[model samples]
Target: MNKVPMTVAGEAALRAELEQLKKVDRPRISKAIAEAREHGDLKENAEYHAARDQQSFAEGRVMDIESKLAEAQVIDVTKIPPTGRVIFGTTVDLINVETEEAVRYRIVGEDEAEVKSNRISVTSPIARALIGKEEGDTVIVRAPGGDVEFEIDQVQHI
Candidate 1:
């Protein structure tokens, strides 16, 4: 399988969730299942069925996280030498050429991309255009709305 690029922080977040699900949620569901089983026949036990469903979901999540971590290639942007070029895990400041509006975005893994948080997926159109570009460089993104031009004001490794 191809390695998936992920920021150190993104990997850490996934690890944290995995640990919580394994140690906390898994055990909690197990207890619930056991308690539900104690309530008598399993055929009519709604609680047991619900608990089993929860267990299945949690187990699936654990497997997904495990697989993702196994294939993840963590990149610590702070440790990389500052090349002034945009890359995964780098926070970039951009100015919309047409509107002159300033915006900041951090290029992150697909799992961590949250537009509200100004984190964009590395595969996003803007991020793809920004990658390998240096500060003061202008980039044009083919956004779904339309083609938008941006000026790279700064790039920070954080």
Candidate 2:
């Protein structure tokens, strides 16, 4: 499998979730299943079915996280010397060319992309346009609305 690029923080978050699922959620679900089994009538017991469903979901998540971790190429941007170039795990500040509105974004893995937090996937159009560009460089992003231009104000390896 191809290695997936992930930031240090992103990797840490996945590890935490995996640990929780394995240590807490898995055991809790197992206990629930056992208790539901004692209630009798497995064919009609809603609690048993629900517990089984939860177990399936939790186990699937564990496998997914483990696979991702196995293929993850964790990058610690903070350890890299800042060169003003936008790269994976780097936080970038952008200024709209026309409106002069400033926005910040951190390029991260697909699993870690959250627009509300200004963390964008590396494959996103904006991040694709920004990657390899240096601060003070102008980039044109083809958004669904239209083509928008932005000026890179700053790039931080944080």
Candidate 3:
């Protein structure tokens, strides 16, 4: 499996989730399954079916998280050298040339991309265009509506 890029914060979140699933969710589901089995008729038991479904989902997620952690390549943004050029984990402020609308986005790993928080994936079209660019550089991004030009206002490492 290929190594997956994840920020320090993202890694922490995943670890916490994994811990919760193992220590809490796993035991809870086991208890539920035991109680469901005590009801006796497994042939048409709704409780058994529901508990089994939950157990399947919980176990799948535990495995998935473990796999991701095993292949994760955690990146510490603060340790990277500042070159005034955009790189992974850089927060960039941009201005649309045509619309004059300003937006700020932090280029992060795929796991940390959340548009509501102004974080975009590094592989995204806009972030790809902005990568390696310095302040005041104009970058054209291919969008669904056509190509959109954006001027890099600032690059902040946070």
Return the TM-score for each candidate structure: 0.98, 0.98, 0.95
Instruction: Kindly indicate the candidate among 1 and 2 with the higher TM-score.
Output: 2
Model 3 C-alpha lDDT per residue in residues 103-157, reported as the tens digit of each score: 9999888988999999999999999999999999999999788999999999987
lDDT of each: 0.96, 0.97, 0.92
In candidate 3, the residue pairs with backbone N, CA or C atoms under 3 Å apart (3 or more residues apart, or in different chains) clash, namely none
Q: Write the per-residue lDDT of candidate 2 for residues 117-138, one digit (tens) a residue.
A: 9999999999999999999999
TM-score winner: 2
Error of 2 at 120 (Å): 0.2
For model 1, give the 10-residue run with minimal summed lDDT.
80-89
lDDT of 3 at 71: 93
Best model per lDDT: 2
